[model samples]
Target: MLLEDMLNHQTKIPTEWHTSIRKVGQKFDSAAEVRLALQYYSIAKRFEYDFYHNEQRHIRVYCRFKHTHGCPWMLFASPLRNLSIMSIKNFESTHTCGQHGENAGNLRASRKFIASQIQAVLKVRSDLRAVDIKNDMLSNFSIKINYSKAYESMVHATNTGSRVVIDADDRRFRRLFISYNAYIEGFIARCRPLLFLDGTFIKDRYRGILLSATGENPYQPPHRLIVISDADKGIRATIEEFFPDAFHSRCVLHLVENFKKNMKDFGHKTNVATTLDELLQSAAYKFTISE
Candidate 1:
């Protein structure tokens, strides 16, 4: 099944691979997209490749054992003329190296891929463990990745929260601060130039901090930032790190809750506590202050 022997045989890819990138002129948004598609195709088919050329202009990958086994598998893609999008130019459907063993798809695992796979789980559970993610990948995707990769993916998913932009490869994940494009646009357009930094301890395996910055929401008109959480030292520190200029305010709701709890602890009657709470709330916002 060597490249030299490929001419004498009628070997070609089977039709069952729904994720195949073999079609010429297949378009993609960027080089990262093309690479990601190739990774998906390889993972789906249980194959591996080495990047022969990976540049801003083009990407060319061949079978990992191309030299040793003379595998004919290869794919090449580049940007179309005067366009930013990439398109597949040439592809060899035959892979002499053949299907790899269990967890072969792990070789193609990237932070972006892992992030995508775990996004659904993250929607339901924030304390998802790296071992659980690793095991899930092995069970669901037939990919056996390192615990570090799983941890990094978990961190990236939690920080980015519904946003993911894969940069380069797994080893060189572009470090970033979190901001959605829509949020940035809203802040630049209708919102004031202020941020409300806050944090809550994640009930996670690592028991880490969940730092956040909030401004006027997308649906709202011009408004000020509001930090809504129980006042914790973590929020003060986080604001110092991410938004040093913005003032941190304790949430009034949390303060009210604490007041009620303290009243109960002091053996105050329920009716008395309720009357005091109502008084505080009505007097709390008599004058207009930025919430």
Candidate 2:
């Protein structure tokens, strides 16, 4: 009857749609029925204005649909809008940084907890790494992470490890690194006038350099690991870039060790060490060293 009424109307649907209108939502229905049903729904739901032009207006429609679904697992609606808008770099620039910043924090904490859970698995079956870190691979971890209430506090609000390691090389990681740099540099700035500089050659098959600086208590010792970087122009640049006011000094023991490695003569080592000590102790050397 509904089909007869639809056919009799002057608003002619294609003849190909001879099937009943009740079955219109099914995919096996005729293409004309599908098309006519879509048209009917578009007009009745006031989606006609949205149908032609890439359905940009359906973004709001999707949001409403998501709200109606009331299932958090159904993140398809949220991701659909995001994936569509992803091509427009300008649309992403505003919110992407903030979203990734929050995600970075969440990832950091998650990765740490993940590692702990994985360690427990490793104790039982150390070969789990060969398998991917999917839910199956990490079933033990997920159980602890998801089910146990006591383990919840271990999850920090801002977990970076999960975000970066799982999604390494992601654009969001790049943005997150920027925010991390800002945070660290701000922290380093607060403890001015004391800088501890040390560099070491990387070991293993490949050799590189690692250098770091931290606030030193003239009385006791520094509390935080202020900075760590390669002993190269990069580390120098970071120092010149971030901690402009702090005093610079090498770890005396490491310097002496390096001197011993390079120089054979003990007398020459003593003279070199003395000269370095004199230069560093002098007021003229303050704020003049590169790092």
Candidate 3:
């Protein structure tokens, strides 16, 4: 399923999750904990705030519009008894401005906040794309975020003690090639004189069109080395230039697809293309020079 759709299909809240009740004298283990609760409150309530004062011992925040609108809403928390045990010293939960959905952009929908919100989805679908997360937030919650934030959000959500690593320089999913040494070694040992090259479109998140080369040795004696692939000019040129002695051939599957495409463009019936494709495939496999 698409990540955006998967996100919309919600699940029951886990036991570890809990909503915060902002009240005076309410204590938290640390200032980070208190800020997280405030973050939850701001996003859920669709409001925004600015940190007026944030220190090791204390943290204070006022409405983001406090300066322009003269809003008086503010909250303050500080270490009460233990240095790390923070307690809410003051909580004024009132907003003068119309806290609309647009406020759920910028600071309100921080990357960390985005990470926390999508962490559950990541657990189930690690291959979830950043764009899908961005779409889900906008469509469902009216939150606007950039692609970089979405990408970093996934990294932060999955990187802690996890192996899913994302390296982004300009905040884009770049090219990649995957191979296994054991498979390569096995192919070499088998001494297959034919190599099959193919590319498949990746539909999943971070799935890019990638070309792969592999060989399988048949029981028959080796002839001149042959390379087969879909008719990509780059592959064709490389094969002809590098291995001049080897014979290069187009993959049979690509030829079949091309035939179907040409028939489709000419307004041929579906069965006509299918019948022709079957005929071509049968002719290719049915007879050999020995026969």
Provide the TM-score for each candidate, comma-separated: 0.50, 0.28, 0.48
Residue 38, model 2: Cα distance from true site in angstroms = 26
lDDT of 1 by residue, 226-290 (tens): 44446677766766687655556766677787898889899999999988988777767778654
lDDT of 3 at 93: 66
Per-residue lDDT of 144 in model 1: 80
> Which regions in candidate 2 have their CA more than 4 angstroms from the true location?
1-132, 135-202, 205-234, 258-291
Model 3's TM-score against the true structure:
0.48
- Give the candidate order by descending TM-score: 1, 3, 2
Better of 2 and 3 by TM-score: 3
- Write out the backbone clash pairs for model 1: none
Candidates' C-alpha lDDT:
0.71, 0.33, 0.72
- Candidate 1 versus the native: TM-score? 0.50
lDDT of 3 by residue, 153-195 (tens): 7766765322233445676656533344456566656656888
Q: Residue 50 lDDT in model 3?
A: 87
User: In terms of lDDT, which candidate is stronger, 1 or 2?
Assistant: 1
The best candidate in terms of lDDT = 3
